[model samples]
Target: MMKTAVIYATKTKHSKKLAQAIGLFLDITVQNITENPVLDDVDLLFIVGGIYGGASMPELLAYIKTLEAPMPKYAALVTSCASGSQKQIAVCNILEEKGIKVLDEFVCKGRILFVSATHPNAKDLKAATDFAQKIVAGGLK
Candidate 1:
């Protein structure tokens, strides 16, 4: 059986909620990136974070840099925000530079600060889960 890890960082809990939904769908435990940053044993890795000022969480980026050499073979990126696509390229670039093959990416609307706080609703969570399932079916190689 292939081993998978669902890790994430969040400030307003939007990313955490999304990560948990993916974890439940994938039958994998969700872990905070700060608590469990090492991924030496995971066959497939999914990193999720919220977008702030057009960038993923700084802590997440720092943790990615700390990953032991020889990054995981298959990895996916997930980001959430009002725009969803915000800061995706920056995170994708960081993972690609680490020699990790990014297999897929998912972005969904999240509750923006105090502006538009109604997000990550049923629709968004369903979309995230669907994305994760597709990535799993694509093979973790």
Candidate 2:
């Protein structure tokens, strides 16, 4: 079996839900980055998080930096954001700098818990899950 790790940072659980969906599809272990994950035995790593303001959570960056494994063949990034911004690119850049090959990047509309009026609903969740399925099926490559 292909070893996969799904690490995510989520404040209100939107990102965590998406990560779980991806994990279900890939049959991998899912973890929260805040809990301190060890990536040594993972063959494929999927980093998932949310974009706050215009960037990803600092903890996610820190976790990425702490990773000690050699670049994996498939590294995927998933983010829950209000819209498609540079956050995904920033994540891709960081992973690339670490010599990790990024295979796909996925983003979906997320609810802003602070600003409850602009939150994503069930439709958005479905869209995100569909995107995750595509990534797992190699459609995002």
Candidate 3:
């Protein structure tokens, strides 16, 4: 079996909730980027975070930068934003530049201040979990 890991950087807990759901469905542990977890021998890594100021958190991007040579073989993204936009192009670029193949990304509405206030709720968690399952079953890495 492939080793998998789920790491998330969240400000309003939307990304955290989704990461936890995916970890639970995959029977893996969910890690907060604040923990500074390192990916070692990870076949598939799930990067979960929320958009702020129309971009991924700086902390997350920095952490991704640190994952150079030891980077996972494959990666997938999960993002949340008030706009419900799936534009984490910056993060995608970094991962690709690190030679980590980005298999896919899943985006959902996230609570950002007053917007998307009801997001990352039960429905969102289910979708995130389903998406993770699909990625695993779809032969990622």
For TM-score, the strongest prediction is 3
**Which window of 10 residues has the lowest lDDT sum in candidate 2?**
111-120
Can you rank all candidates by lDDT, best first? 3, 1, 2
Q: Candidate 3, clashing residue pairs?
A: none
Q: Estimate, for each residue in 1-141, the C-alpha lDDT of model 2 and write its tens digit.
A: 556788899877888888887777666768998889877656667888888878888788877777675545567887788664435667788888887788777676776645434545666556666766665666322
Clashes, model 2: 0
Higher lDDT: candidate 2 or 3?
Answer: 3
* Candidate 2 clashes between residue pairs 3 or more apart in a chain or in different chains: none
Question: For residues 1-141, what per-residue lDDT tens digits would candidate 3 score against the true structure?
Answer: 799999999887888889988998999999999899978889999999988888899999998988856679898899998888856889999999989999999999987668888887899889888889889998963
Candidate 3 ranges with C-alpha deviation above 4 Å: none
State TM-scores per candidate: 0.91, 0.80, 0.95
Regions more than 4 Å wrong, model 2: 84-86, 113-120, 139-141
Stretches of candidate 1 off by over 4 Å are none
Model 3 residue 100 lDDT score: 91
TM-score, candidate 2, is 0.80
Cα lDDT of all candidates, in order? Answer: 0.82, 0.73, 0.89
